[model samples]
Target chain A: MTPDAEQTGGIIEVRGLKTQFGDFVVHDGLDLTVREGEILGVVGGSGTGKSVLMRAIIGLKRPSAGEVTVFGQNFYEAGGEARLAIERRWGVLFQGGALFSSLTVAQNVMAPIREHLNVEGDLARDIAALKISMVGLAAEAGAKLPSELSGGMRKRAGLARALALDPELVFLDEPTAGLDPIGAARFDDLIVNLKESLGLTVFMVTHDLDTLHAACDRVAVLAEKRVIACGPLDEVRRADHPWIQEYFAGPRGRAALAAKAS
Target chain B: MADSPAYFDIDLDNGVLKLNAGGDWRARFLKAIDSRLRDFADDSVGRDLIIDMSKVEYLDTAGAMVLQRTFHACEQRSAASKFVGANEAQRSLLEQVEHHLAPCFVAPSRPNAFVAMLDRLGAGVSEAYFVAIAILSFIGEILVAIPRVLTRPARVRWTSTFHHMEEAGVDAMPIVGLMSFLIGAVIAFMGAKILQLFNAEILTVQLVGISVLREFGVLLAAILIAGRSGSAFTAQIGSMKIREEIDALRVLGLDPIEVLVLPRVFALVIMLPVLAFMSSMLGIIGGLIVAWTAMDIPPALFVSQFEEAIAMSNFWVGLIKAPFFAFVIAVIGCFQGMEVEGSAESLGQRTTLSVVQSLFLVILIDAFFAMFFLEIDF
Candidate 1:
C-alpha cells in the first residue's frame, strides 16, 4: 500500500518544525506526517537527530518553532489538559524495557491504568495480569519484580505496559538494542502482529536493519538534521545519500536484499 | 690513598642521621653481632667492621633482626658499626624498631604525622562537601516534587506511592526493629557502668528514655533509612533512566516527576514519622532490659520513670525531624539517581553519595533542632 493511501486521516502531522539546543541546531525546518495505521521507521546513525525528531513529535522536548498536530490538535502549542488528553492517546516502548525495579511486572503495567483511568484493586490487578499474558508472559510472572526478569521478558513487560491504555499510537525507541538476534526477530514479529491486529500507528526509532526490513511500512532516513529520504524500502535503498548508500550496502543490508530477492 | 676499600659515609649530628647519596641496590645484608660472632673467631675482634646497607632498600625480618644484634654488639665492643647512606624507606624501617636501639642511633627528621593527617582530612572534607551538595540537590528535587504534586494531582498515582511505601517502610521493619533493640541494649550496658560508679543506677531508666526518645532513636532510624531506602531510590531512578522508562513515561503523556517522584516523596514524608516512632519504642524496650536486670529497678518503676521523662514534646521533636530527614533522603536518592550518567559505575557512585548525603543532612538537621530547642525556653 502507498504511505498515504491507506490512512483514514493523519494521526500526527509536523510542519516546519524547528528545534535547537543553544548553538546546536538539532532539527531545522523538519516536516513529516505519520498517517493512521502505518509503521513509520525512523532510521539514522548515532547523532543524526532521529531520536531528537521522535522527542519533538512526542512533546517530550518542545520545538524551537513549528507546528505538530496530533489528532487535529496543535500539540506543541497545547496547554494543560489539552496536552495530557493528546498524550493519553499514545503509548511508548523505550529501548531496554525500563521496568521499575521496585515494582512487580503487574504493578508496572498497572501504573498507567491507575494514573490515567483511576481503575483500582481487583479490576486493576486483572487488567495488569491480562496485559502481561498478552505479551506472552505467564500469569505468575505478574508478581515478579523487574530485577527477577530476563532481558527479553523485561522488553515484553515494557510493551505490555505501553499497551495498557490500548492507545491508538505507539512510539518505540530502539526496542531491540541489546537483544540477541532471535529475540530481536521475535520482538519485531510482535510489533508487526500488534500493529496488524490492533490497527495502531507506530513511530519507531531504530538502527536495527532487521526491524526496518521486517516491520516498517515506510522508512525515513534522517541525515544532515532532517529527513534525507523517506519512502518504501526499495525506494529508500535506491536513494543517493552517502550514509544511506553505505548503510544499505553493508553486510546486513546485502542479507536483507538477498532475503527480499528470494 | 692507601689500599683501603671505600666505605659509605655515616654522619650523625645533633641526634639526626643524614644520608646524602646512594645508588639503587640489588641486595645488601647488615649482619648482626650474634651471627657474625658465630661465624668469626675471637681473634678477629680487633678488625674494624662496617655495614654497607646503603644498597639495601628492603629489609627482611631476618635482616632487620640481624642489624639489631649487630648494633648491640658494637655497644659492647665500645665501637659502632655505622649504617650510612640509608634511604628514606630504610630509615623508616629502622625507626619502627627504634625502641630496641634507643640512645645508640639517632633518628632522621621524620615527616610530621599531623601534617599528613591534615592533608588527608582536607581531601575527605572536600568529598564530604560534594556529598553534601549532592544531598542538597536531592532535597531540592523533593521541593520540586511538591509543586508538581500540587499542580499535577491527576498524575500523582497514590496506588503506586502506597505500593512503594509498603516496600520501603513495612519490608524494612524487621531490620529496623532489630537494630533498635541492639542499640538499646548497648546504651543500657554503657549507662549501667557509669551509673553504678555514682550509685545513681535508678536514673538509668530516665537516661535511656530521654536519650532514645529525643536523639539517638530518631537519628539512627533516619541514617538506616537513608542507607536502605535512599539507595533504593537512586537505583530505581537510575535503572529507569538507563532503560528509557522515564522517556517512555513522557512519551505516554505522563510526567515522570508527577508519576514517579510525587508519590515517592509523599510516601517517604508520611512513613518516616511512623518509622521513627517505631524505632523510639524499640529503643526504650532495649533500655528497659538494662533497668530490669542491672539497676535492680522493678519493671513497674522503669516504666513510670520512662513515662515521666519522655514527654509529648520530645516525641514531636523527633517525629517532626523524621519527615524532613525522610524528605532529604528520598530526594537525594532520586535526584542522584536521575543525575547518573555513564555506566553502572555512575549508579554505584550516586548510590553511595545518596546515603552519605542523607546521613550528613540528618545530622546537620538534628544539630539545628538541638540549637533551636536550646534557644527556646520550652
Candidate 2:
C-alpha cells in the first residue's frame, strides 16, 4: 500500500508472515493488522505460536517469509536508519517482566529515554520518576533493583520502562499471566488507563479472557498456523472454528463472561 | 488519508482566541509543537482559548500534553479554556491526561563526597568480614560432615563423588601431564645452560631430578587443577545456589555440606596425590629426554645421575604438599560456589574469584612447605 493511501491505515501491518523452527512451522502466511489507538488482544492455545507471532513482528525472530509494516513503512525491507526510525515509535514489555537485574528500577526506565532522547541526567531521572508513579508505584520504588521488588511491582516497572520513550505503540506479552485475580484486574485497568491517557496503540498477547473483555478493543485468535479470527470480543467469540468454539463456550470462558457482566 | 505534518493556526476574534490543530501530532513532531505552543501561550494568556483538534491526522500523548499544558496555563491566567472539534477518542484521551497525568518529581541530591567515601569504606569492610565468617563456618561444617559421611557409608552420595572425580581429576590428566612435562623440559634447559658456564653440565641431571621430585611436579599439577577444576566447581555450585537447589536439599532434611561439599573435597584429596605422582614421573621422563638430546648425556648416565641426586625424602616432600593444595583448591571453589548470590554476574565474579583465591593459597602453602623442607634438609 502507498503512504498516501495509508492515512487511516494500520500502525502495524503483518502480511503473509511465515516462521519456522527447523521442520516445525509456527506461522504460515499469517496476516494481522493493528489499527491506530486500539488495544488488540492476541490469543491462542499453549503451542499455537502466539509469542512467536509477536516476536516476528518485533524483529526478535526473523520470518522465513513476510512483511511487517510499522507507521506505513515496511520494517522488513527498510534499511538500518529507516528501521530504527520505525523502531523508535514502539516499545515492548516482554513476558516475565524482563527488567535489567543489574540496574535499579529508575535506571531501567531511564535507559530508553537516555538512548533515544537528548534529555539531561536530572531531567531523565525526573521522567523516570514520573513514569514509575504513573504506573502507580511509590517514588521509593525507583531506587530498588528488580530483584528487590515483588512480582507485580516488577511487572509495573517493566511497563514503566516500556513507556519510557513515550512510544506511540506498545507490545505486551502475557501482562497478567502470573498475577492473582485482583492483581490481574488491577493490571488490566492500568493498561486501559495508560492506553487512554497516553493515546497508545497496544498489541498484547494474552491468555486471560477477562483482559479481552475488560481492556481489549478487539481480539485476534491464532490457530492452525494463522489468525483464524480477528474482531471485537463478541464477533470473534462467534467464530465457527472448533478451537474458538471450545474456547469461548468453555467453562472458564463462561465464568469470565459472568465476571465481566457483574 | 493524510500524510501531512501536524501544524496549528491561531486566530483571534474579539476576546476569544481559537487554535486549529492539524497533521500527525506524535512524538516525532513533538519538539516543533512544544515551542510553538509555548509561543502561542505567551501571546494568548488571559484570553478565552479554544483548541479545535478535529483536523489532527494523529494525536498521541505528546500532542495531547502540548494542548493540555497550554489549556492549563490559560486557565491559570483566568482565561476560560475548553477543547472543541475533538472526536470521542481524542476527547477521552485529553480528559484522561488532564485528570490523571502524574507530576514529574524532582531529582534527588547526591550525598557529600567525603561522607559517601566513608560509607563505601564501611560497607566494604563489613562485607569482607561477613564473607570471611561465612567461609570459616563452611570449612567447619565440612570438617564436621566428613566424619558423619564416613560413619554412615549408605548416606554417602557415591554417584556424585565419582562424577566429580571424573570431572576434576581424570578429565584433567592429559593437560596436567603435558604441562608438567614442558615445565620439566624448560627447567632442564635452564640448568644445563647455567652449569655448562661453570663446566658442571652433568649437574643438570641432579637439578632436574631434585626439582621435578620436590617442587615443579606437584606445583605444576596443583596450579593446573586450581585453574581448571576450581572454576568449574564455583560455576556449578553458584548456579545451584541461584536456582535454590541448595534450599531444596535442605528442605529434604539433608545437609548441603555432607551431600554436596564433602564428596567433592574427598574426591580432590584422593585424586590430587595420584595426579601429582603421575606428574612427577612425567616430569622426570621429560627431563631425561632433554638431558639425552641436548647435553649428549646417555640414557644410562642420566638415570644413574638422577637416582644418585635425589633421595626418597625428596619425593615425600613434593607428595606431602599435594593433598594440602588439593584441600585448599576444592574448599575455596565450593565455598565461592555456595556464596553466589542472585544474579549471573555474581556467579561469574565468584568463579573468577575462586580460581584466583585457590591459586594464591596453593602457592602460599607451597612456599611454607618449601621453607619447612629446607629447614629439615629434605
Candidate 3:
C-alpha cells in the first residue's frame, strides 16, 4: 500500500523450526518469513501454538531445532553483545500487557529507552509520552500503575512501551482480544495508521478476524505444527485446507468480512 | 563520522525558509537531528516554511517528529507551512507526529508538608483504632468458633495440627535448649559475682533455679516462637488472601476461621507449654554447669539446692503463661494475614506488622502476668 512495502525484503526468516515443552511437541518443521514493512497476521485455533510461534520467533523461546534469522543474521548464533542490538530493533506486546507492576505507566514505557539508549532522561520521558499518546492512552494514565488500569487501558500502555524504542518490527499477542468492539476497531485503525507512518513490520498473533481484514496486509494460518498457508487474506481464504475453509467461511468470519466490505 | 548520513540544511526561499532533509531518518539516527531542530524551536524564522523530505531515504516516526519540529519556530508565528516533494509514507508519519506533540511531564504534586504530616497522623490514629476493633472482633469470632469446634472433635484438622506442631514445637527443641542454657549460665555467673562479696556465692544455685523456672524459660520460648512462626503465619495467610483462597473457602460454605485459624491456635497452645517445660529443664542444667564450674558445686548438691529454691509454684507460674502467649500470637498473626488487601507491598507490610505486634503484645502480657503472680504471692 506504500512505497516502503514496495521495496519488500525478508526481515525475519524461520526454517524447519522445532519447538517442544517436555514431552509434548508444539511446532515441528515450521517455516515462515516476515517481509519488511508489512503486517503479517498469524491466525490459528486455541492451543495450535500461535503464541508459541511468536515466542519462538522473538527468541524468548529457543527452538529445539532449525534456524531462525532476523535482519539476515542468525540471532541464535549472535552472542549477547550482537543480540542486544537486534533485541533493540523489535518490540513485543505480551498477551497480558506484562507491564512492570511497581513502575508507573510512563516509567514502564521509558524503561527500554533508558536501558538501551543514551538519550537524556527528560527527552526519553517526552518520547514515552508521545508514544503513550500515539497508542491512544489518556495523559492521566501515565502516572497510574498497571493494576490501577483496566485490561484495555493496560494493553494500550503496553503498546506504548512496545513502541517506545520506535522499533521497526513489532510483535503483538492478541492486541484486540480484551478490548470492546469500539476499542478494538480503534486499535485496528491505530495499527494501520502506525504501519503507514512507521513502515513497521508487524508480526501479530490474533484471533480477531476484523483485525486481519482491517490492519493485516497478509495472513499466515498456523496449524498441525506448521504454517499451513501464508499469503494475502483472499488467497489464503481460498486455500483448499479444511481449517482455513472453516475459519474464513464460518458465520463470524462472514460477519467480519461483511463489515469490512461495507 | 566521516560521512554526513542524516542531516538537514536551512535556506531562505522567497521569505519562506526551505529545509533540505536527507539520509535514513530512522529512530536510531534521530538524536542528532532532534538536537539540531531545537536550535530552530527558539529561533524566529520570519516567514512561511517548507520541509523538503524528497531526498529522505527512510522516515520513521521519530524522524518525522524531528523534521516537522525544524520549522515549528515559523509555524508558531502564524507563518503558513507545508511539506514539499514528500512521499506518502513521510507525510503520514509527519502528520502523526504533529498530532502528538510531546506533552510536558508533570510529576504528581505532593501535599503541603504540614498537611501531609497531619494526614499521616490522622491515618495512624484511625489505623490504630481499626486494628483494635479488628483484633477484638477476631477474638470474638474465635471464641464463637471454639464452642462449635469443641462440640465436634472431628472438626479439628488433625493433619494440619500435627504439621504445625512439628513446625512450632518438636523441631524447636534444640534452639530452646541452647537459649535457656546460655541464660542459665549467665544468671549463675552474675549471682556468684554479687553474692561472693557477702560470702554467699552458694546462693547462685537458688538464683538460677528460681529465675529460670519462674520467668526466663517461658519468656524466651514465647519470644523466639513469636518471631519465627508469627511472621510465617501472616505471610502464608496474606498470600492466600491475595489469591482469593480465603474468599473461595467462604464461597464453598466453609468458615475460614475453622479451616485456617483454629488448627494453628490449637497446635501452638498445646506445644508452647511443652516447650516451656523443656526450656526450664535446660535452663536449670545450664545454671548447674556454671555453678559446678565456677563455684565447684557438685551435680548432686546443685540438684538438692535447686529443689529447695524453686517451688512447684514457680514452674507453674511460668507454664501457666505459655498457652495464653501462644493463643495471642496465633490469633494476631492470622488476623493480620486476613487483613491483607491485594498488593505484594500490603502482604509484606502485614507480615512485618504481625511479627512486631505479636512481640510487643507478648511482652506486654508477660508484664501483666508478672504483676498478677506477685499480687497472689505465688
Q: Which pairs clash in the backbone of model 2?
A: none
Expressed as tens digits, the lDDT of each residue in B144-202 for candidate 2 is: 88888799899888998999889889999999999888888888899999999999989
Report how far residue B271 has shifted in candidate 2, in Å: 1.9
Q: Model 1 chain B: which ten-residue window has the lowest total lDDT?
A: B24-33
Instruction: Give the candidate number with the greatest lDDT.
Output: 3
- Interface RMSD, per-candidate values to 1 decimal: 37.2, 3.9, 2.3
Candidate 1 structure quality by residue, lDDT tens digits, A9-49: 57888777788889899877776778888899999889878
Candidate no. 1 TM-score: 0.44
Which ranges of candidate 2 are over 4 A from the true structure?
A: A1-9, A238-246, A249-251, B1-110
lDDT of each: 0.73, 0.85, 0.86
lDDT of 3 by residue, B46-165 (tens): 557787887888777667766665656566455458788788767777888887765634245579999999999999999999989989999999999989998999998889989999
Task: State the displacement of the C-alpha of residue A253, model 2, in Å, after optimal TM-score superposition.
Answer: 2.7
Give per-model CA RMSD: 29.4, 5.1, 4.6
Per-candidate TM vs. native? 0.44, 0.84, 0.84
Candidate 3: the clashing residue pairs are none
> Would candidate 3 be rated incorrect, acceptable, medium or high by CAPRI criteria?
acceptable
Task: Quote the positional error of residue B196 for candidate 2 in Å.
Answer: 3.4
Candidate 1 C-alpha error for residue B348, in Å: 7.1
What does candidate 3's lDDT look like per residue over A120-166, in tens digits? Answer: 55567767778888998878888888888888898888998898888
